[model samples]
Target: MDDLIVKTVTKLIIPFIQLYGIFVILHGHLSPGGGFAGGAIIGASFILLTLAFGIEYTKSILSAKVTERVEIGGVIWYIFIGLIGIAISGVFLGNRVAGFPMGTFGSVISGGMISLITIGIGLKVASTMISLFHHIIEED
Candidate 1:
């Protein structure tokens, strides 16, 4: 953690890693990567940070309360999106029938609620991984 090389490398690469993760999540509906892959990527970035900087430092950045809230928020967001389908189409996760606009094809925002769902899933997966990592590391 005190090594300048590792710290510098982590600082340099963490942002890009996180950016890629977000990209994966956003493009999940249109591409191969999705919530799970993107979330794992994001979680890996945090893991890298923890490895490079130490648990205490990572804790300062992402406290227990904040992580819990984020996780819960992701779950709530997912449920809310599903509820929209129920309200609109009387079916859970109803896409077009729920009146979600299918935008221009091949566009980033073209997948109706798919993008939103994946975003929520990505958040949940990322938080879950971080939490598990923290717990496992703290088990000592």
Candidate 2:
């Protein structure tokens, strides 16, 4: 952790790793990876940062309170989106029937609520992972 090389490498690559994670989350509907996979990727990056920089430094960047809020927000957003479907068509997560624009085929916006749902899932998963990691580390 005190190694200059490790800190430098982590600082250099963290952004790229996080960016890739976001890409996976956003393109999940069109590709093989989805919310869970993308979230794991992002979580791993944070874990890597913790390993390189120590828990105190990591906490300064992403406090436990913020992580908790993000986790709760993700679930709430997902439920809210589901409620939208029910309100529109009496079906939870109803896409087409809910009157959401389908957009062009094979496009980012084509999946309607599916993409939104995945985004919520991704955030929830990532925040949960970070929170668990912090708790486990603090227990030591």
TM-score of each: 0.95, 0.97
Tens-place lDDT per residue, model 1, 15-119, is 999999999999998889999999999999999999999999999999878878989999999999989999989999889999999999999979789999899
lDDT of each: 0.92, 0.93
Candidate 2's C-alpha runs over 4 A off are: none
Residue 103 lDDT (model 1) = 96
TM-score of 2: 0.97
Global Cα lDDT for candidate 1: 0.92
